[model samples]
Target: MPDHAILTADAHRDLRVNTERSAASGDAVMSAMVVPDELRQVQNEYPILFRRNLEHDRFTALAMFGFEDGENLFLEGTRWAARYLPLSIAIQPFLIGRPEGADTGVRQVHIDLASPRLGSEGLRIFEEDGSPSPYFHAVVEKLGMLDAGYQASIGFLAALRRHDLLEPLSLEVPLADGSTHRLVGFHVIDEERLRALDPAAVAELHQAGHLMPIFMALASLANIGALVARKNQRLRHG
Candidate 1:
């Protein structure tokens, strides 16, 4: 559980966050999360797919970390190997909160007071005069970008659904130890369907600036093989 509190300069001026990366600091295996604005970068490192929210019955974009739960192939001795970390992973311990009884459409930043990352020697949230620090400003900017990116993703997902371009994916992988791993309940862009799209629909997607991301998501499938290779390497060495 997270001990969340609205961040204010007056109350938590001296708060410092630990920027270290290690499992002992609670940085461990991570599952896929939605990232809308990082399709190109994410495609280079992680396999982008769609996952169903069982409760909501809605599809969400995911960046696969490992073949199974609690297994992160990107974890290399506490350091994530990927050059591009997902926005959801990078924004840990802080979340955008809605202000109480306000209607300006502004979101407040809330920090997890009990996060392992909180320490005595990291980025300061505020200066001695209660002014926001540069680090805090940067985090705010990032959060803003994250918000806009995810908002844009809503339409992107709707368009994909409109075109029926998502299809269920089932993967079977053979490990080095002569064992097989089966993965299910995931979806991917139906390349055939995408290619078969009517020209007018393709033109509309192009006009809407969603064509490239679709291609990037399709290209991200290649990373699944890389993930398998990393998993195999870990199994062999460990």
Candidate 2:
């Protein structure tokens, strides 16, 4: 259960959050939700795939780290091997919150009191003078970027849907030990449809600032091979 509390300098002045990269810190996951804005950096390290939220009738981008649940191949003991950690993964134990019955569109920072990251021996949220610490500011920045990117992703997904550029993706990975893993229920940008799009359609997507991320998502598929290699290496060592 999550015990969420609105963050305030007085209440959380001495609060410290562990910054370790490990399974105990909640870094052991197969995938994390991603946004179009971060797709450029994400493409370099992880395969980008789309999954549908049936309840919300929406599609969300994902940065895949492994083939199964709770299996983070990029995580080596306490270290994450990726050059760039996705913002969604970096922003932990903190979430954007809205006050009840408020229509001002103001956002508040909420901290999970039950998070394992909350302890007495990590980064302080506030200084002795009750001001936000540098680490707090960085977390806020990541939260802001994540919030804005989530909003922008709506338009990006709409553009993809409008042009019929999304197609189902099913992957089969055969490890060196002859064990096979299959991943399904994901979608990817349809390169064939994108290539067949007329000039005017492409121009519209460009004007809407969705073309770059579309291409980045397509390019991210190349990392799938690397992910397979990591799985194989893990299997060989064990």
Model 2 lDDT per residue over 1-238, tens place? 8999999998999889999899998888999999999999999999999988889978899999999999999999889999999998898899989899887468999999998889899999999999999999999999999999988999999888889998999889999899899999899999999999999999999999999999999999999999999999999996
Q: For this target, which candidate reaches the highest TM-score against the unseen true structure?
A: 2
For candidate 1, write residues 96-177 as lDDT tens digits. Answer: 8888888857788999998888877888888999999888887888788778888888889889989999999989999998
Tell me the whole-model lDDT of each prediction, alpha carbons only.
Answer: 0.84, 0.93
TM-score of each: 0.93, 0.97
Which TM-score value belongs to model 1?
0.93
Clashes of each: 0, 0
Query: Which pairs of residues collide in model 2?
Result: none
Query: Which residue runs does candidate 2 get wrong by more than 4 Å?
Result: none
Question: Could you tell me which 10 consecutive residues in candidate 2 have the lowest summed lDDT?
Answer: 97-106
